[model samples]
Target chain A: MARTLITVPRTAKRDEIIEIRALVQHSMETGYRRSSDGDLLPRDLIRRFTCRFVPRVAANSNAASTAGDLIFAATFHAAIAANPYLSFNLRATTSGTLVFSWEGDNGLAQTETVSLLIA
Target chain B: MQPSTQALQKDDTQNPAMLWVKDGEALWNKPEGAAAKSCASCHGEISRMKSVATRYPAYSSTQRKVINLSQQVNLCRVTQQQASQWPADHESLLGLEAAIAKESRGLPISPPTQRQLADAQKHGEALFNQRVGQVDLSCRDCHETLAGKKLGGNVIPQGHATGYPIYRLEWQSVGSLQRRLRGCMTAVRAEPYTHGAKELIDLEAYLAKRAAGMKLESPGVRP
Candidate 1:
């Protein structure tokens, strides 16, 4: 799994747009490059990234559902550099957890979670 | 530097080298080796190391030579911490160097000047002026004479060491000043000294002196 870094505010006022930033370590190798022996290096990169917010569990619920509304998403290509860094804003509606996930070539997938509190 | 590169350096969140700095913070506090001592055990809080990087490539009486911060770290590892030396360009070494250099941010570069170091300093000065390799170009040719001029669509920087452990867009990673020097030598088709070699140390000393009074900006982002 690629190393990841995620930044999100712990608390924010209702309806405020909070900044969210994330970075993931990957080679993002383009297929055009050649190896020392002249063999072409295969392209490998994080192809997709998604962020969603899971709302606070209801009082009657035993567990919070896994699904949530998508906050942000991006599709990447070989042009992206080694570490894909992304920053975006989120409008706070309620206290919840922000889940970030990335999918890439060679079966690479990574996810990170951060909590957000509504004040 | 390009505006985009400068922006990356100014914003910690945008600087990719911050990832290594985070890793270095962990290594600083984590104990290892036979002595079970971490860098923190000796150096205490990293804040105490402020401006330390600027004073490096200074004379070391114990070694009877000038040594850079990376060499000092290795010396401490082997002699004090009872750990093996990290290989050249090792991620752990680069991480620790970046973390240490980060502490010295905004401080001025000030290499030592003492009677004993005068000879080594002279040697370094000579090396900087001497032309070699197929291109036969000296450091003065570009950095001193052609500074601020455009070359191959890129501005020629004075080639100061102020921003070492820099995140070069070309490298796509953080690297040391010595590594940059080696790259320059290779560009001129000159033979580069081995990592940790005395010649490299002397060159570093001279560069540090040349950059005196310049602000330190390690883990800097550059194009």
Candidate 2:
């Protein structure tokens, strides 16, 4: 499994834009490369990544909510180096959790989340 | 180096090595050793160490030899801090080295040029050009003659020591120049030198002199 690192501000003002950075540990093996034995190394890379912001809802509210709103997403390629890194900006509207997920070839997948407190 | 890797180096949040730097910062203030003297107790503010790393592999009158920053740190640990020496390439040692080097970032490489160091520097120059191992390749073969060319699908850099205690993506951790040099020896199938070996110290002297004008980028990121 690929290890991940995520960075998010611990606190932010309402409607403020905050930067989020993420990185994952992966070989990002491009099939174009050959091993010492002259055999082709199979391709393995994080093909996709997504970030979603799930706003905190009031406890008394009965509003229906799902997995949060998608804030950012990216599609990667084999050309990406090992340990893929991604960074983006998100506008904070309310206290919420940011969910980051990555998917790769050969069923490689990993997810991480961080909380953002708005004052 | 790839553009992406360079970008990672500039951004602390994205640079995995920063994690170690953070640990180093913590260790700096925290007391350790039998004397309970933390690095801060002696070194005071880290800012005082700025540009200190630029003049390493210097001649130590007491030791009667050239000593790199890592060795100096070990020396302090043993004598001043009253602590046992951390083994070579230990994470804690690398962390301290990274912290010290980080302070000197962007400074020029300026290893000492005293008369005492002349002989060791010559030995280092010879080692740099000498061919070794089954492949019979010398550091000059690639870093000098074949630099800017492809090697194993990656561009061969000038092999400057400008950035050390670097966070190498391959190793997925920060490491010292000696560790990287050992890796090079292994790549050429040569007998690797033990850490703190005189031969390695001599080679470091040569590299420091060769990279004299280059900027320091310790805790640098590389692919």
Model 1: per-residue lDDT, tens digit, A1-119?
A: 56677878789999999899998767799999999899999989788999989999879988777788898999999888888799999889889899999998899888888999999
Q: What local lDDT does model 2 show for residue B194?
A: 95
In candidate 2, which residue pairs get closer than 3 Å at backbone N, Cα or C atoms, i.e. clash?
none
Considering the two chains of model 1, state its CAPRI-style docking category.
medium
Query: For all the predictions, what are the DockQ values?
Result: 0.56, 0.22
lDDT of 2 by residue, B1-223 (tens): 9999898799777887776676677788888889899899998998888999999989999888889999999998888789999999898888888888899999999977777677778899999999999999999999999999999899999989888889998876778899999999999999999999999999999999999989998889988
Q: How many residue-pair clashes does candidate 2 contain?
A: 0
Instruction: Locate the minimum summed-lDDT window of 10 residues in model 1 chain B.
Output: B112-121
- The local lDDT score (0 to 100) that residue B179 gets in candidate 1 is 88
Q: What is the per-residue lDDT of model 1 for residues B101-214, given as tens digits with 9 covering 90 to 100?
A: 999999899877775566667788899999968999998899989999998999999888788888888988878888888999999999998898888888888888888999
The deviation in Å at residue B214 for candidate 2 is 0.8
lDDT of each: 0.87, 0.87
Q: How far is candidate 2 from the true structure (C-alpha RMSD, Å)?
A: 5.8
